[model samples]
Target: MHGLAKNHLKKILSTCSANRDCEYYPCHYNNQSCLWCYCPFYPCEDEVLGEFVKRKDGTLIWSCMKCNWIHKPDIAAEILREITELTLDKTTECSIDYLENRELLMQIKNKIEKKLGKSNAI
Candidate 1:
């Protein structure tokens, strides 16, 4: 493939679709793909997408397996772009700070939207 085509292919490979034939697949409603099997912005405090559950052992678990926000194509692509900008390639740790401080997240979103020349539609 040409260099430009190869570049586009690389972008797609950044978060490809999950296997549809696998059992226990389509874990979320609407059959959203699990491209983000492990969310980078995990431990988030998005009450709409996740919640905290206390186990019998008195340990709190952040149950987010059912959240399909990251599985959406646009969201996944935007997240990958933000990660690239943040230079988080070699980072293994993520913070819940963005949850508490939404400014950071909003700044990134605004920048991305401006770059794409898109309005922040609801």
Candidate 2:
């Protein structure tokens, strides 16, 4: 995603880290593996987004049936909503499974605190 604000990245990191239960899944960026799980809420039927079982090379495997709506999200807005339990407007596009795990959250917390200092509100 381009045009990502600094605050967006910060938010994504924190919210994803809120869930320490699951391990972060790896991603492919710049032709390399980037182990960063990017989902916040627990997996459920409601959150039953879609499934993609691709070959090890990331090729498409198979699929079932679901809505055809395709929308990319903003990692920042999503994290803020997930962790803080706040709702964002529909216009707010948070990343899907971007800030998903606790490590990402800790990272965001550290960065925010470092920038604004310990007394600053995130």
Candidate 3:
């Protein structure tokens, strides 16, 4: 892994905790992992996992409320591992930027879909 990514990943992984006391405890399901309170893959735009909803203001925004993929412990761990491995050769100003790379995002999505035997609808 890249030096920066390794350090950042270590920091993030170290802080993983289940905040069951939060008001939104079990936000997605009874046993969902709280490691990702805010999804790193926001606005993933993956129709299978999420969709765009139109608000009363006539504006549409991606809603992942129904998606529980990342909340699964195994999936979350796999995602972090994939991210670390994928960034081994790439360089970015911020380690988190790797998540924003289109190709990397697609790869992560594909892996999740494969593990779950689902197809992408995006």
Candidate 4:
């Protein structure tokens, strides 16, 4: 938690809401958390979780539509917690950096891998 204010952490955590009314509700799973409508780790280019798809224009883009690792409520909460702990500045109450923190990114990848196991089940 570092020195992050309790209220601020709570505020961040509160954003992890499940919107069931949306047309694309349950986009990944029966009870997936809609915390990230768009993944924070887009273009990760991780073969285990995603891959490059060739579009009609022959442009390659990373596609993670089948990856549901982050949709799990617990996983989403943990990721949010880790990100806040790593990026939030206690004094300024601002997020100084996010993806630039290699350690944090690695931690997230390792957690995803551990959960996915050898099969990489969607």
Highest-lDDT candidate: 3
Q: List candidate 1 segments past 4 Å from native.
A: 1-15, 88-122
For residue 93, model 2's alpha carbon misses the true position, in angstroms, by: 8.1
lDDT of 4 by residue, 63-113 (tens): 887777777777777777767676666433445344656666776757755
Q: What's model 1's lDDT at 94?
A: 46
- How high is each candidate's TM-score? 0.55, 0.23, 0.69, 0.67
The backbone clash count of each candidate, in order, is: 0, 16, 0, 0
Give candidate 3 regions above 4 Å deviation.
Answer: 1-17, 88-93, 116-122
Off by over 4 Å in 4: 1-15, 90-107, 111-122
lDDT of 2 by residue, 1-122 (tens): 55577778756544343323225321212211111233232221222334556778979643312311111123333335444442243223453344455566555544533543432111
Predicted candidate 3 versus true structure: per-residue lDDT over 90-110, tens digit per residue: 676566675667777777767
Cα-lDDT of candidate 3 = 0.73
Query: lDDT of each structure?
Result: 0.60, 0.36, 0.73, 0.69
* Model 4 lDDT-worst window of ten: 89-98
Better of 3 and 4 by TM-score: 3
Clashing pairs in 1: none
Clashing pairs in 3: none
